[model samples]
Target: MAVQPVWHFNRSALAAIALSTLQSGLAQAITLMAPRQMGKSEFLQYDLLPHAEEHGWRVRYFGCATVSPRALTRRLQEALSDFAAGEKWLMRQFARLAGQHAATARAAFPERLVQELAQLRNEKKPSLLVIDDVDRVLQLAGGDTLLREILRAFAGTNGQARLVLSSTLTGHHQGLPALLQQQTTVLTLPDIGDAFVHHLVGQYHQLTRTKREDDNPFGKLSPYQGITWGQVDEGIMQDAFNRLQRIPYYFRALVEDLVLNPERAPAEALQVQLARLQRHRVAVLSWEEMSRLDRLLLTEVAKGTRQFYGDTLRQYLAAQTGAARVSTSQVQSSLKKLMRNRVLGQEADGRYLIIDPHLAAALSVTDKA
Candidate 1:
């Protein structure tokens, strides 16, 4: 099937890379690690979900950011409901089969879903399971101990059942995917190459229907244009693509928004959008309203200590700030607050540091960068 090749940058290629994995019966798991706006989740919803259905598999999708690991059991039941949609043919057949054995229908699919040996023999089609935003849930729920429990029940059934799981982080955490990594096929997401980004700009331009502009984003996307045609030199294209790679999504958005406004320079628009994102990331932190105890914790973190663990690190905050030493539970609560604020990074070793060096310099939110 032809891909729509959305201008989200690297998504169609990523989809191509992912869909190709289905050719192998061996489970090929992947994590797309490109920039935030590269449309990793969109690729799954658009490309993988429907395409996997062609193999006669019923795809089950749940997101960790949308639902916690502790909620996996209930959420899986809900996905079964979506699978058993009123208009669905498979569900119709399930219901028809149920009429003959009314007692077992409700529990049967789920029971068989957990154990593939029985399902493989009696099932009419294949099945796929998807869990998205696993990293967020792992961060929130303390790893995917609960989520892995559900997945472990379905292990070693790749031929009859396959799974597609997504998380934002690249490395293993105390997360669901990490626990299951030994059995999974891991794929890392690649960023957009300098060679074809003009193609990305062109794709978005077609979506916009704008022909020309002042300091145009689309027309002068040098890297894409350079390798693309005789219109621009390769050196100039490479130079431009290199300098602006950090903000391709910003460029796309600028082009799209400015297409109608013609008066805007795409570069200036890009600056505006990136600044807006940083501000938004920062503003989301304000809702926390850090208590005096919380501020004390932050004050300790600015001092920098390796032995200072997550909540333990925060303990130094209150004690050193001349405030009450935060209670064990309060310190734990403060740790979560800092993590959610994106102002601190917690290593697998249990140490919490500022997000990254560059972001530390940005002095806004602590990004994993």
Candidate 2:
């Protein structure tokens, strides 16, 4: 969000919606889902953290991005040392990190881990495990098992521990929403401060010396064909916000296309930029409607550049189709389809690409459930 004079919106309201959703006990965890950069972290750091602190919840904040199953275990071990009582399961984690040769450290630690975690209950303080980008790392480890581990490990009314996992997967990540819906309470981030858009417009215009009222520069370019958005109209603005509000990364990407790249301003280039956004919205919306197997294939391909095959796809998907065996021919067709839709793309190297950062994030959830 850009800084502006004369406040017009209270962005904190978005955070309030998330804060109120927190619950104690074996009660379902609260999953903060929204678009990237919409302040998912801000909601955690500023709103939830403060309340958790007031409630005396010890926070072991972990960012799931770039974390794998192995990496995740390490981070959890470290976090245990940070917030849990003395003599935690951490030494065992350290030995695990040291490798299997360290036999003593190989001792079962879950019992000790549970004991130390239970200790948080007696502290005159409430402790909450705050994990950010919960979705991103989950995809890396490849499933919702991490979610089950976290909940099983820490979620309970013992008031000793609570889980608050947040990510920008609400409008995207078709897989996570349903997965989370099981033991996780769902709450659409309520409409933000009404002034958010107006304030943003004012700030942008003031900074750039442009305004919707004073001038509609794109109005000149509106004559072009295939432009999904044009003219800075209320409808256009709302659409941008719809994408931006659900996923903050879209906004950043939008600003880059609209304001940052003035060198290629207007006409074909401009249309292409907006077309980029529209494609992502389509993929996200469409992916949300896909079956679990189909969605998981997307999740796998999205991990990085790699050719997916029948065995690989089957390993991830519950059912297999004659045409979708994921062999060379099948992957080629799937890649072609994902690319045609503009969600999965390809590079000069011939590997499929994911042009949208938001989609990548969706593919990467650790499991808000």
Using TM-score, give the best candidate's number: 1
Q: Pick the candidate with the highest lDDT.
A: 2
lDDT (C-alpha) at residue 260 in model 1: 49
Reference-based lDDT, residue 50, model 1: 62
- Candidate 1 structure quality by residue, lDDT tens digits, 143-241: 456445445544544455556666554212332245545645666555556645566456545644434333266456532221222223344434444
lDDT of the structure predicted as candidate 1: 0.51
- Candidate 2 C-alpha lDDT tens digits along 181-243: 676665444445435555555554454444332345556542223423234334454566664
Off by over 4 Å in 2: 1-10, 23-28, 35-39, 54-57, 66-70, 86-106, 140-146, 167-174, 177-179, 190-194, 205-247, 252-369
* TM-score, every prediction: 0.59, 0.53
Q: How many times do residue backbones clash in model 1?
A: 5
TM-score of 1: 0.59
lDDT of 2 at 38: 55
After superposition, which runs of candidate 1 have C-alpha atoms over 4 Å from their true positions? 1-13, 19-25, 28-35, 50-73, 80-112, 115-126, 136-146, 156-158, 170-177, 180-183, 204-248, 280-337, 340-342, 353-369
Worst 10 residues of 2 by lDDT: 1-10
